[model samples]
Target: MPKITYTQPDGVQSVVDVNEGDSVMRGAVLNGVPGIVAQCGGGASCGTCHVYVDKDNTKPLPEMHPVEDELLHCTSSPRQDNSRLSCQLPVSAELDGLVVHVPETQI
Candidate 1:
């Protein structure tokens, strides 16, 4: 299983073990990470799962896809260079130590 840490704006952190092939968003949602509300499931149709990939592992993560780009623009929060839709990240051996930061809110 790949391990991921989701840190909220208030500094609350939730670390979850995710099965290979599962989206990081799904892992957050399933584990009850408060800052993530995956309203569009893993479709990338909504940006409720927006998060910032940790800079250390950001280069190792997959590049954003077109659909993810579109949805990322929907986030109510301002986007940053490292902004990403968690649904676009797949759980895998290469992402064993991925860290993501959940903004204060995503509506």
Candidate 2:
């Protein structure tokens, strides 16, 4: 299990042991963390799972796919250099202790 943390807009943090192969969005949604609706499940069809990847230890994440990029641009949250769709992030040994910041809101 990898330890992943979700920083809320109010600065509260929810940390959980994300099972390997599980999407970050699924871990958050299943754990009842706020700010990630994951409306399209893990299909990358919706930007509701948008998050801002903290620069620290972010290099391990996969590059943004064209679809994810397009969807991020259309999200209500302001697009950021670190913007990522949580559903696009899969838990892995390389992602141990990963930290993700939940946006103010997800559309």
TM-score of each: 0.92, 0.95
Cα RMSD of predicted structure 2: 1.0
* Residues 1-51, model 1: lDDT tens digits: 788999888887888999899989999988888878888787888899999
Candidate 1 global TM-score: 0.92
lDDT of 2 by residue, 1-107 (tens): 88889999888999988889999999998899999988888899989999988877644888889999899889988999989999999999888888889998786
Show where candidate 2 strays beyond 4 Å: none
Which lDDT value does model 1 have at 15?
Answer: 83
Please give the distance, in angstroms, between residue 94's alpha carbon in candidate 1 and its true position after superposition: 0.8
Which candidate leads the pack in lDDT? 2
lDDT for model 2: 0.89
Model 2 pairs in collision:
none
